[model samples]
Target: MTGAGGNPAPSLPGRFGPSFDVRTVVVEPGGSRVYDEAEWRGAIVLLERGRIELVCSDGGRRAFGRGDVLWLEGLPVRALHNPGREPAVLLAISRRPARR
Candidate 1:
């Protein structure tokens, strides 16, 4: 699940402090997703979707298609939108180092 901002929660090991993680997420067509900022362990989340819209808390929106790579920082993510015209799928990877 996403955190307060628009980022997902960091991995279990990162709950304590700064760390990194990689994850894969899927977004169906006409569906929407949210990722909280604090949940992110300072990792950049790479997303690949099939015709979907990425929404940010600051009202920043981006449309992505298949084979597209979207990057997310440790800032709270607002929302992810799928128009529903077709099924949209997303693969997300978060990269960060474990906290010592």
Candidate 2:
């Protein structure tokens, strides 16, 4: 949910701070997948295995390898593809929205 000033409210409030939700994303060898920008707007993505390449909306591209961590917020990323011959795994961690 949204809080004052139109910011996102956390699912778990208080001392420990916000709760997080994690999702697994796997891209097969030579395969591509659309990035879920809406759900992962401010997410932290961790490359678990293999490699990942981002296709940018502005015609640019970037690549990441295993054990790499990145934030996708405000990034103009369009799609994610695996350039290697093995499947790539990533963990997307995002804040859990407050309940109504």
Candidate 3:
């Protein structure tokens, strides 16, 4: 996925350009968490199993399940709405340069 004006999505893997950091994050089911954009850069949160509720900065919340891909924009993440019976595995990739 690309950003405004066709800018490529911030990611770590690449043929060229600055490489961003990548990490795996796991969220337990029936749990909710929040992270700011300053903390988490652009990331593709891949849902491995169970369910995850995603809440954007604009108060938008949605649930995603296994094999689902979620694009995390450089904005304040409100919460992770996971109301399932299992844990949720997420691959969080932070690729934005630190603010000076």
Candidate 4:
């Protein structure tokens, strides 16, 4: 994601384990970013505040606002755009298979 000054946002910091991980991200207004779908295979995204537009690989676009919960397992998310004037806060929860 890009910050207010057009600089890339700082890397998300979070704890990871064998089965799960969680991260919080904040996108500045007009900021746009992309993520590797394979890296987030079984994740769920929770929109905490503000608004964002999610664009899929097939060019489909969907807008989400505060309190919206999205499942990302099947959709190929190509990009995320913050369209609101305020920052957009989101929580990403990813589940992983148990390690052998």
User: TM-scores, in order shown?
Assistant: 0.52, 0.71, 0.60, 0.66
- lDDT of candidate 3 over 1-100, digit per residue (tens): 4422354444523433355555556566577767655445566666656788778778987768887877776555687777888766665655667768
lDDT top scorer: 2
* Model 2: lDDT of residue 9: 42
Model 4: per-residue lDDT, tens digit, 1-100?
A: 4534564443542344446666567778898878566645666777877898988788988999998988765667788899899889777778766678
Q: Deviation in angstroms for 47 in model 3?
A: 1.2
Worst 10 residues of 1 by lDDT: 9-18
Question: Of the candidates shown, which would achieve the greatest TM-score relative to the real structure?
Answer: 2
Candidate with the larger TM-score of 1 and 2: 2
> Arrange candidates by lDDT, highest first: which order?
2, 4, 3, 1
Q: Candidate 3 vs candidate 4: which has greater TM-score?
A: 4
Candidate 2 local lDDT, residue 94: 76
Error of 4 at 38 (Å): 2.9
**Candidates ranked by TM-score:** 2, 4, 3, 1
Winner by lDDT between candidate 4 and candidate 1 = 4
lDDT of 1 by residue, 1-100 (tens): 5532345543433343334344545565667878655544444444443477768677888776766655555544587788756545444445454457
How good is model 2 by TM-score? 0.71
Cα RMSD to native, each candidate? 8.1, 9.8, 9.9, 5.3
Model 3 clashing residue pairs (backbone): 30-82, 53-81
**Worst lDDT window (10 residues) for model 4?**
9-18
